[model samples]
Target: MHKQSVFSFISQLIWVYILLFSAVSFSQKLTSGFKHTNALINETSPYLLQHAHNLVNWQPWSEAAFEQAKSQNKLVIVSIGYSSCHWCHVMEEETFSQEDVAQVMNENFINIKVDREERPDVDQVYMTAVQLIQGRVGWPLNVIVLPNGKPLYGGTYQTKTDWIKLLNSLSKTYKEQPEKTTEFANRIAAGIQEKNEFGTEKGSVFFSKELLNTNITTLKENWDLTYGGLKGQQKFMLPANINFLLDYVILSNDAQAKKYIKLSLNNMALRGVYDHVEGGFFRYSVDTKWQLPHFEKMLYDNAQLLSVYANAYKVFKNPLYKERIEETYQFLNTIFKSKKR
Candidate 1:
């Protein structure tokens, strides 16, 4: 080879080696955090093990923690989150990992950490309250409950400063205003009882075709045609409404309604929310175009979305919709089906 050609060949070889080394370095960094240990070392779930060594005296979800709070006459702080949650990890590092914050928590509150996945019953009860109280719900839920387990306040992740201030303020209020706290708790308990009583009695309303049309119009107002689906970023399927749209389009032969339904389904199916590698829909899309996912797949969401897509296919005779239905079914069969029996 000519001298210049030989030099060029050597340069290409060096570039290839550099690329390989960079790849290995990135992989090492990703795995390096895996070596750290926490109080969760012996815990059953990988999520719990990930938090084993935090400064906060973290206790697993147990009756003992609740009992201790009651006996100590301390308020209970229940922090609920899952492993895949990015905010959960941030809160742990910023708030739970701080010595002063942990000190305040240890001195004034009986803190309990719960993996929402492991104890979904607990998560549901509190999450319901979070929605009722805050008019919304999300991960890294922080709820402060009375000794008797009645939640007084709830919020999502907080900055270290905000969390510390809130904890101190609550502690002071609980200490100085015992009578007021009792009165407030009694009112909340009564409200819950009244709500339960009301929920038990179902009132039936006569439905008409007009009412159905009104619902479809309302959904259309929220629909996003440019990116597909309804609402802004952090898009959810709203399967109930989608099924209604499918029914409306088939019954009324409305082309515009059918177009919107197709747009929503195709956007979700093609985006990261569909989990191209894993073959199941994620919890929700974090972006307007449904390109990024929160990555926690729920069985219920899959089941509901599967039914919607299957119905769409049955009505439209569209192979694309049929393919989505089949793929979702296969995911359920392969991942969720149990052989325990």
Candidate 2:
């Protein structure tokens, strides 16, 4: 036990050292063939590092960034996305890298790039507002807000032309008709506040097996037998859904449930989406049978999956489950240790 604790201590120290070195490496601006530098140069997030040399005046989400917008009476352009997001990278290359689009964004909007993993609270608030307006929310989530910090307009990835058009239109609408824009902001803010009013919501008086059984029944209804996930896998949230079912399996001890769990685990681990070359999972399997994949290695995905597999190993002492947990841990400990503040 003491040896295990010592090994853990050394492992953590090594991780810390790696993160510190990485932060220092990312601090230097990459100057090869870049159009210009921006405020993102001062940021620590790996996602922000990817945008440090963009022509857009990209600032990390901060009190100072918002204050600068307020003082200049400029609208805020909050772009929230994570490091491993494919669409976010696409938008960066297509729109933010373009000279014309960057000029408009810099001139009219205080553009802020947020790592959603780093600031989920900020993401939650603005994403809620985006959902309120657009009826959905997604990565590369671009939200335009008033100088006073109320959301005005929000959308996911737009074409370069469309983004330029949006920047111009919102700037115009905001300047020329302050009253209309203010009304819109007020309405959106109110809606966001209302949706967020879950503070007073009652919790269950007590836990019950009946409630668990009901949820398990819902799971059974949703289960895709052709594929292993709860639903047909255009995308897979295996860690969240499968991990929960694992607890249900242990609690119920249903023979069928155990078989299903094993089936799901084996398919996910053996599938192309599981990253045979790498030690982590792709974001999801694009195909229903987990053949094709969306290859983005998210920290949360690997982190949650590590827990799920680790728990599975603990219970069943399965060699496959143990191997998965070890591999996933290695992947996360190596790649996701960014120096984001």
Candidate 3:
């Protein structure tokens, strides 16, 4: 009984020390020696609040921010990411927190921090712009918008060195060749508008097994026999379509489809992108081997992934798929779920 009491007392002391250290660390992070005034301090979104103490002059997305951009004749730098985004946090630490980077941002651009979850309308607009420009889209989506709120240029994550150079180059271009910038923004804005245009849609089409077979053939042709994902350099999660294919193939008992699904899932599961240290998957692998990830953990991506893994488990009875589903949700509950939920 005496020994039990001593162990309990030690555990209690350890817990107390942990609590105190956590509080002090959090307090110091919020009220650090370095400070700057920015509009994100007044925002309620957790993503915005994360940047409240950033040395960069980060204003929340609002009419006021655009108005300030218009008045100052400055380009608006829209940095779009959600609160749980890993690379977003990385950029915050390596770039936004740096004095030199912040100085460039504060002087040249009216920087706006957007929580994609909070302002999905704005995110949709800019993501389309990014797609139109670069032919692809992903977060840490950085878009340089004109003073009139036109997205002139957009891309995903960048290193601090490349980011600084891009900032300098874009700023100089904006100053020297204003017309070219306006023309590009005009084209992008038009493309964004055209994105929703499905002019004169076909009323109906007859479904056929032949059509399905042809589609599966296309997938099989491009399917990487060795690496498992689509035959490409990139490794987008591509869950919805892949999941649908898996279900259809299983229903039809197509051996080729089954082979493709198993290979893709196995490759993705046995990779670095699955976050072996944690319980979730990252945005995508940069290589065909699924080794390097962009490291953003969006809820939508995880949800889609969960559905895919759950279906795979249901069909194949694979223990790996079951574990992936369980661990993914564990990640969501532990890191992504807010107190409000």
Model 1 off-target regions past 4 Å?
A: 1-46, 83-86, 180-191, 202-217, 248-256, 331-341
Q: Against the hidden true structure, what lDDT does model 3 obtain?
A: 0.87
Highest-scoring model, lDDT: 3
Error of 3 at 241 (Å): 2.2
Regions of model 3 farther than 4 Å from truth: 1-32, 199-202, 205-221, 232-234, 247-254, 270-287, 290-298, 313-341
Clashing pairs in 2: none
**TM-score winner:** 3
lDDT digits (tens) for residues 75-95 of candidate 3 = 999999988778788898898
Q: Number of clashing pairs, model 3?
A: 0
- Please identify which of the two predictions, 1 or 2, would achieve the higher lDDT against the true structure: 2
Candidate 1 lDDT over residue span 1-341, tens digit each: 99999999999999999999998887566446653333454577766756776767777877888899989999999889888888899998888888899899989998888898898988877886677678878889998888888887788989999999999998899999977877776666666666657746568757998988887788779879887787775898878888878878878998888888888888888878897875889988888889888878878899999989998888878788788888888988988778783
What lDDT does the true structure give each of the candidates? 0.82, 0.83, 0.87
Q: List the residue pairs that clash in candidate 1.
A: 38-52, 38-53, 39-52, 39-53, 40-52
Query: Judged by TM-score relative to the true structure, which candidate is superior, 1 or 2?
Result: 1
Worst 10 residues of 3 by lDDT: 196-205
Model 2: per-residue Cα lDDT over 1-341, one tens digit each: 69999999999999999999987776543554566888787777999989988889888888898899989999999999988789999999998998899889888889889999899998888989989898977799889988777899999989999989888998998889989999989999999888878565788666687887887888788776665776753858567777777787777787767777777777888888788775888888888887788888777778888888887777678898888777877777766666572
